[model samples]
Every structure is written in C-alpha cells, then in structure tokens.
Target: MSTTDDFDAEAWRAELEGYRDRKDEFFANERQSPIPADQRDAFDGLTYFDPDPAYRVEADVTPVESDETVVMETTVDTEQEYERVVELGFDVNGETATLVGYTGVGEDRDSLFVPFRDKTTGQQTYGAGRYMEFEVEGDVTEAETVTLDFNLAYHPFCAYNDAFACPLPPEENWLDVAVEAGERLPEV
Candidate 1:
C-alpha cells in the first residue's frame, strides 16, 4: 500500500473512482443498503467532498494493551464496547496529532475502525462525525507503520436516515483541522 505523502495522482484518481462507483451502487440499491427505505426514492446518490490525495497520511501505529475497554455511544442510544487496538500519530499540515483505532473484542479482527470529527463538522461534513476503516489482518501490531486514507472517510449510516445506528467518534479522536475530504453531508 502507498502513503498519501507520495501520492500518485493517477493511481489515487482511479481508486477514488472505484470508491464513488461502489457508493453509488449502494445508495441506488433498494435492498442491502443502510439508507432508509422510505427515503430511497428521493436519494439521488450520496454526496462527497472532492477527493484530495493530501488527506491521506502515513501514521505510526502503536499497539495498546489495557484492561479497560472503550464503550462508544451509538445514535440509537445504546453503547458497545470496543478494544482500543492501536494509537496512530501523524502529521496534518505541520501539526502532530494522534487518533485511536478500535477493534471489536472477539476471536479476531480484520479491520481498523477509525471514527473521527474535525473542524469541518457541522459545515462541510457531518455534524456528528465521519468514519474510515481499512482491512487489516489481526491488528496494527502486525505493522508498526500504516497508511490512513482520510480521503475515504465517510459519513455514518445514520447520516442518510435515523433508522440505522452508528457509533459516535470519541472526543479523543477529534481533530482541530478541517478534513475536507471523503463523503459530505447527506441530503435529507
């Protein structure tokens, strides 16, 4: 996998197109979609911020070992516990910031769940937060360094309709900078 710092414009463009196409299919489909059934008719496809190669960052990953579990609140008013699997430190525009990556407590995890909020919240992006998850075998322990493609960050399921419950990003994962990438606010 390539980091965004050495972004290959041509490659990133192709990947972005694939992402948009998949989302378009998901939103347009009546079944197997997170979008509310009642609102499906009016859905013209989900909105997104222009893909920016700059949003992708290479992060240093550190494994977290703690007895405590993070219980995240969901839009449905319920809470679920997830293990804080890794800590990611990266530079965003000359400033150093850190974010936590979570994983479900089970036999094994195949992905890193990164949910975060930025200054763009309530304006350019979702007021609640945005999510980015990458397929990883086991945990970040396998690799001390990993790539965080923020350009693929996306609005939660609840953004489309309230029926689907989505986890809220913890305050610790919030960023002070405006991440003008990925999916934008959904039309209601």
Candidate 2:
C-alpha cells in the first residue's frame, strides 16, 4: 500500500487539478448560458469539510424589522436594478444579521431580506452571506417574524468570479459561530 505521505501528496495534486478545472468551467458556464436550475441547487447543497469542524449553535430568535432601502446595484450596466431593503433578524444564538429582500408596492405585500455572515466566512465558507430567500408565512407578520437558518446560507457569484460585484455582508450580519452548511467556494 502507498505510504500516508504519498497518499497526501496525491490528494493535494488532485485537489489542485480539480480547482483549476472548476475555475475554467465556472467562467465558461457564466459566458455560455444561465446555470441550470438543478446545478444551482446542487451547489446550494454543498457542505464544508472542515479540518476543525465548528457546528452551528442554535440561538434564540429575536424579532426584527427593516429600516433601510436601496436600489439593487449591478456591475453590468445594461441590466435594470430594483429597489431592495436591508432588514434585520437574529440567529439561534441571538447574533444579529441583515436580510436582503424585495419590497412590494403595497405595505402588506413587502418581502423580507435576511443575508447573514458567520465564523465560517473565508475559511470554511464564502466570506459573504449564504443567501436564504424567504417570504412571510401566515397572517401575523410582526410577532410571528421569521428567524434565519444559516444552514441555507450561500455565496454570491462574485465568490467565483472577480468580475462580479456582489454586495458585501453588513457588519451586523457577521456572526461569531461557524455556520457549517450551504455552498462553499470550490477549491480553486
């Protein structure tokens, strides 16, 4: 059998090769067509293989509301930007974070945005919020407010491409725990 040192060297080389292949394919797919929906879901389901696993701790839910609004800004000039709001909510740990979502014309129809960051940023996961798209459930939108689950967080396209300009996670959204779920930046 191959020695442990030899096995490690082979694994490192394989990882590097995989990263390069992924980088090439990422740009190619971006240029070619919209990423397939199934492919997107697959990426969204990725889990971190942490050398030092730091599982997410459940925190108490803290009710929150949105107070800021801005038009969606895009690096591509041709596409139209929509108005969005930066809302606030808490994790199971009571750590505060921002949610990014759409606002409707009528007061009752507005949706909530919940972007967040965690200790996994830049190390085990993307440095940006793992996005979780949510809509208000049931009749009571105030007291029955929803709390975000970091297991559903994700990285923006910018995580893969330098050409993409994704909004950075706000300071409040940054968490102190290692959120160990969702898509991770490919090894490349």
Index of the highest-TM-score prediction: 1
- Could you tell me the TM-score of candidate 1? 0.90
Report backbone clashes per prediction.
0, 12
| Model 2: per-residue Cα lDDT over 25-141, one tens digit each | 664454442345335534432333432112232223333354444444333432323334433443443444444444432355345544557776777677655655556555324
lDDT of 1 by residue, 1-188 (tens): 24545667888789888979888888878487887777688778778877776777889988887757888899899987888888998987667889998887662567889999998888888888999999885546768888888889989888877888889999999998888888887545
Show model 2 residue runs off by greater than 4 Å. Answer: 1-110, 138-140
Q: Pick the candidate with the highest lDDT.
A: 1
